[model samples]
Target: MVFELSQSASDALWLETHQQFMPVTSADGLETISKIPPQLGKGYEREVALQPGVELHIFDSTYQDIAIHIPENQHPVQFMVYVSGVADSGDFIYQDANWGYVGGSGIQTPVRTFFPGAQHQVGVIVHVQPHLLAQLFGNSESKLQPTLDVLVPGDEQPQQVFSSPTTGAIRAVVRQIIDCPFSGVTKRLYLQGKVFELMALQLEGISTPVCQNRMLKPETMARVQQAAAILRSHLETPPCQTTLAQRVGVSDRTLRRGFKQLFGTTVLGYLTEQRLALAERLLRDTDLSVTEVVHCCGYSNPGHFAAAFKRRFGITPRQCALGVISAQS
Candidate 1:
């Protein structure tokens, strides 16, 4: 199917295309989940209002080849991540683990085409109001990082579009959003935190020059991603860099460079970040004590773990467990 629609006509567009798909709203009216029509394909699309100025859209489905033409219009800042499938716009093509940022006023639009494939197209799109984004950066007086200046562009600044391969850390966060295990207000709070996390990852990616300029070969990038998966699967005893490089069939040097370029961090740095993130989740959701959480996250010294946890999360494990802090805080 092919159609043309304005960026603001989302509800009307959805209604026109999927007449059979009914939106089921949650009890609190904060979320709506709609299944794909049988004739179109399989799976569903979920929309959540995380807060007054932030929204989350999660889609997982497969269908016949489709093309959508978006007319020139103003748009909110959007962070888009695709876990699989292919989307070809005139100037850019997005595929598995690809992410991009698009926003600005009075910008020309592209004809985005999605091709049918064996695997489902799954991912999340986060929309944040320009003012909210500015507030998150501490208002107009705060200096925006050079790379992210486009996000809050001046009236005369041209619209900007940025795209890149996502890091393992980003994919992990995306999965957490897809499989969120909470409901009601807790669910909104959790997803809101994740939306910000996604924004932070994109901010980190753009801030680093190497991430913008250094493009690894597809095979090498795949190996680096594999190495990351290994680290996540074995957080308690991740392989050493040399061993990991060997396992992924990349040289140690290549692995190091790839990690920096694709993930914006060193191998060890990424591992540490992931471990600390896991620790935070455990402290919040599980009944694990501080010491047990530390051990589960592969830390030995309680003092060292507490220090690192505080550095990463701005709160100690005990504080997080006691509900003294939230994911957004």
Candidate 2:
């Protein structure tokens, strides 16, 4: 029998499962004695550990159609590996955002993270810090999009896709992070190196190598990225762009232009988009009501929220929550 989970309550469930699997800290070293119990009809499972500074979560399939709400415009640059059963049906849709197709099919040569927004079901996700990835790439300024709706399946590169050898190397680093036994600052350092190697690979494929000898410009870019990060870090109560600019040491004009150029949206626009994306994900993935979702996304007026949502997505939040949104290709 197939099971379904309520969108509203599943977050608590996710948190509960996360806490249960986390390792207990001791004077000796970081030891993970906890193990996830196998569920009924469980085909495969593994207990993985992330480098200490990074946190990891393994979600069960109680909710077959799981939706994650990433309220920030940027997500941790993550590398994912599928270690088990095939995800027969699912696509990471990039609805208000942009995404591209990455390669992955059953029996494929275990490709590294080459495909942009590659679609899959069963896989491991690695969340690497952007600064770390940038340093590794020698770019000094880098930001990866956080919210990917659903991934398209195809060998052909889709619109807004970012594919390069560097991304693949990041995938390799994820593999190493999963398989290696390094810890402490050493682990972070090695991971940084692996990430750099990944970026280098990406550079190999790019027709225009702008990153070459571009260390001087990264300082300004890094500040722009830092401002965006501040917005994301406070997603619950995200501040205005003016405040964010002051904190990040960039002019409001610079912040606005930089985010638009890099992320395809203005800073405030990106924040709103993030909130709406989070609301949409919760609507589908959780059991939250429209009113509850309103509060969750930081909107006080449900009617205003509904109108804005419809304008951006062509359907009311209610319609989406009812699973009536048309499937995109």
Instruction: Give the candidate number with the greatest TM-score.
Output: 1
Using alpha carbons, what is the TM-score of model 2? 0.44
Total colliding residue pairs, candidate 2? 20
Tens digit per residue, CA lDDT, model 1, 102-136: 44322535545445444578888888877787667
- TM-score for candidate 1, please give it: 0.57
TM-score of each: 0.57, 0.44
What are the root-mean-square deviations of the candidates from the true structure over C-alphas? 14.2, 15.1
Q: How many steric overlaps are in each model, in order? A: 0, 20
Task: Mark the regions of model 1 whose C-alpha exceeds 4 Å error after superposition.
Answer: 1-13, 16-19, 37-40, 98-106, 138-144, 210-329
- Tens-digit lDDT track of model 2 for 273-311: 878877887788679899999988888898889987887
